[model samples]
Target: MLFAAGCLAILLGITHSILGEVLVFKRLRENSIIPNLTGHKFNLRQIRILWVSWHLVTLFGWALGILLFLLADVNNAPATLITQLKQVIAIAMCGGATLVLLGTKAKHPGWIVLLSIAILVWFT
Candidate 1:
């Protein structure tokens, strides 16, 4: 179960990096999506800062996923407690993502499925 979780975390990290750093940021810089959405124009510097900050946060998330993977492999009591805490955090995050996506009328079945699997894994 931990191995499966680790694999999923790595996969998610890669997918998130590509989506945020490559696709989303590229389009934001090249298009009018931001101004169109906000009804206000931002200077190039501000846009660049936002872009960099976004990537930084994405990278941090990736790091956290990797940490979770590593921590999951530990075989001590303290490590087990930490792993369970991490699992709880993951469950909350996944649940929140699922709710937000569904509330926005976006496709969220994947997150729901992930949440379910994580719950099962956590208990086992």
Candidate 2:
């Protein structure tokens, strides 16, 4: 459970700090500033660069996280339970990923996934 919890913490942290910035602050930073405006002269481009770099790094982090979570879950779970739970998790995860990938960030989709995770946690 500790390992799974650790993975969840890292996952949530990356989702919030890294991906959330991309999803939230990216637009704000884009629209908030006027291009070619000079501060220290380095400020404008720096924010853009930071945004891009952050997104890129977070993409990598997410990729790593998917693999890590998969491995961690597999490693921690007993074989019988793993088989029983695999299909449910796959459906929930893949369906959730598909919905999120389709450019829908509505609360419904995320909440559904959250509820499914809750069920999984409860059952397992």
Top-TM-score structure, candidate number? 1
Q: Which regions of candidate 1 are displaced past 4 Å?
A: 27-40, 75-124
lDDT of each: 0.53, 0.47
Best candidate per lDDT, number?
A: 1
How do the residues 50-77 of candidate 2 rate in per-residue lDDT, one tens digit apiece?
4434443444444444545555565456
lDDT (tens digit, per residue) of candidate 1 on 1-124: 6656767766776787577756655555345332112214765545544544454345445546655665666664786666766665665556544543443334334445556665765676
Worst 10 residues of 2 by lDDT: 99-108
lDDT (Cα, 0-100) at 90 in candidate 2 = 51
RMSD of each: 9.9, 10.3
Model 1 steric clash pairs: none
